[model samples]
Target: MTDVNSRPPSGTSMRPRNGAAKDAAPALQAVAEAERDRLIACAELLFFAYRDFTSDADKVLEQYGFGRAHHRVLHFVNRNPGLRVADLLHILQITKQSLARVLKQLIDEGFITQRSGREDRRQRLLFVTPKGTRLADKLASLQIRRIEHAIHAAGPGADDAAKRFLFAMIAPKDRDRVHALIRLPEALDTTEHLEQPQERT
Candidate 1:
């Protein structure tokens, strides 16, 4: 008599009980196809949105013989005065060599200045020059207008919904760090997480 636990012979196909395994293939395929469609839609929307969003800034930067890299460094430096190089690296997630090239151009053109850290002398803290501030503010205002128009078109409560969506889209591991970096106001910090209250338009 054959043992109840004996394995199936090699080269033989084994069917799962009740044909469940065979039935699951189509269901799994349908789910995968649906997910793929959703992802494709999201990816296309993001691509178009980013392309249009950066166009205005790109035009302005070209006039100054600068590129997006310069604009980014200038913008961050302007927003976070006394930004340390290390912190900038963390925020930008770029290599030191890439940052150095852009930073050198800005520094040489008098768009940015660096000074030793007050507490830690070895740390280089970055600040935007007056000229840099003007340019950065201009670039920001252009983007802000675009964002405002888009949010308004999206309808009431759209701004809050959009913010939630954007925050959720961030990588889980980096969300906490990003929240801390942005530093939402205390009154708006009702949640333990970084879901901020809607701004009074």
Candidate 2:
């Protein structure tokens, strides 16, 4: 066994002092500590970035008398055309009552339309109308531009790095759902379509 007392002095640790009493700390301990610190700092950065990223959309939603919840419902439904109510609620993880209220308002506003499923009478398939498409297009356009600018600033490598980081952050329970989404051809195709009003060419 290699003596634990031979570590290079250049690499000191910020962890609790117990590991350092000996001349050399375990190399693995240093690596773990560095990773742990990076994760913590990255978490804070993600929190701040998400807040700033959503602020513009929040303002637009407020003008339409909707909230972030409504934007989320519309955006997902818009992306996945003909999605069922049950599946939507599952993805959103919101109570039926809450979803019902938002769905009702969106339908009433002519932003979304619901059609009965041919196979299952109880199932309702939803889609966004031209009006909703317009709004969603605008909202999405802004985000696309933001993302494009970010990519330009950081170079294409950053986009792949960001995706890797995001995939790693998914909770174990949500991994299956995320996998299903990632495998979607349409999802990948439209992911870059992030415009306020997507051009349907």
Q: List per-candidate RMSD values in Å.
A: 9.2, 10.9
Candidate 1 Cα errors over 4 Å, as ranges: 1-24, 185-201
Clashing pairs in 2: 137-195, 137-196, 137-197, 138-196, 138-197, 139-196, 140-194, 140-195, 141-195, 141-196
Q: By lDDT, who's the top model here? A: 1
State the lDDT of candidate 1 residue by residue for 37-117, as single tens digits.
998999999899999999999999999899988998998899899999999998888999999999999999999999998
Off by over 4 Å in 2: 1-35, 182-201
Give the lDDT of residue 5 in candidate 2.
80
Highest TM-score among the candidates is held by which one?
1
TM-score of predicted structure 1: 0.79
